[model samples]
Target: MAACAPDPEPRERGSRSPSASGRTARPGEGLLAQWDADLLEAAGAGDAASVTALLDRGARIEARNEDGRGPLMLAALADRVEAATVLVERGADPDATDDLGDTPWVTCGVTGSVAMMRVIWEAGPDLTVPNRRGGSPLHPASERGHADYVREVLATTGIESVIDRVNYNGWTALLEAVALGDGGEPHQEITAMLLDVGADASLRDRNGRTALDHARARGYGVIEDLLA
Candidate 1:
């Protein structure tokens, strides 16, 4: 999800430098404060040049909004590949989770951008990290019918463990896909990918229902056939 905090208001032209309230400006604090919002703003807007320029002007690359979302996470949520590339190259940590327990890598699954995945993958994300919901990246990708991400994260990364990881809700990637998907072509593809990648379909939900059981109940014929 994109950072929920609204963009910070612009400082008035010719205003005094921004500073942390109730404290004297440190050597570089004022500069960082002035551009803190600018860095995140550039990232979310996919302005690689602006992001680079802001950083070059002493803007902290890790500056965050009220939600504690750094530049890389904002770029990830926006699917701003160019901006993310600049952030990553400038040492933004893809593995770093925000206040919501969402890392740039985790955001990739929700955004469904294979390009973003590639960018984050190069940073070597700790795939074992779970989001606030105790779900892996595969969970959202599966539920959202991100077939391309399902194929990439599983097929290329060779990480079968993600497929079977159960969320706090007792919904594994497989279960989430079956339970939350729309029973459409994209979802069918995701189901097939999960199965092919060794997702443990035998696992049951909190209600003790298997994926096939859910599929059957949902009248998802193709998924039922796949599961059967």
Candidate 2:
């Protein structure tokens, strides 16, 4: 006859069961989660070597943070040119948007990094996608008086027709330049670039004010002349 096994000891009262404590995760989940954290940190710090190593170690290239900011977007936001290049080359989507619906293109414009812009451009971001602020890459660039960004957008092959596209405020790139500019040389350069690319001076904002109107109202003599 086989001997009976001893009875298992009872758990103490109020002791948590394994299932009650937490859900069981697959083995890969733990590794992937750690990798996600490492990848985001590396990307935010612009550490291209660390980013590369993490990706090679099975980190998800498209991992995002709480704000919906993917690694590529982080690299762009941090002005990590090499890190951005690595992510883009690894097939990161250039058009991936963050919580504010800001794509890498808009981020590049905000950061005023032409080098990042070039890398993202090679990945084929949509030139016409608007951010949560109801503006495109050109809108923020012009609004912030980033002449180089404006020039880059104009120089890109397919964006010629979108130069005068309006944002949620019905303000065109030219309108933003005139409305948000400080009337400095940078704004002047941006306005000139828009005009040189054939931005319509006659366009109006949601307030029914044209770039010329805004320029005149702001006492921007040079901009008024350019629009005129």
> lDDT tens string, model 1, 1-228?
896998988964444455668553443556558688888899999999999998886788888888989999999999999999988888889878899888898888898999999987888788898887999888898889999888888866656766688889999998889999999998999999889878888999989999999999999999999999
Worst 10 residues of 1 by lDDT: 22-31
TM-score of each: 0.86, 0.86
Worst 10 residues of 2 by lDDT: 12-21
Q: Looking at candidate 1, what is the lDDT of residue 104?
A: 94
What is candidate 2's CA lDDT for residue 175?
85
Q: Output the lDDT of residue 223, model 2.
A: 82
Tell me the tens digit of each residue's lDDT in model 2 across 1-228. Answer: 999999989954433244455864332566677889999999989999999999887789888899999999998998898998999889999989898788877787787888899988888887678776777777778888888877876786467677777777778878888898888888999999888988888877877888888888889999888878
Off by over 4 Å in 2: 1-27
TM-score for candidate 2: 0.86
**lDDT per prediction?**
0.87, 0.83
- Candidate 1 — which residues are off by over 4 angstroms? 1-27
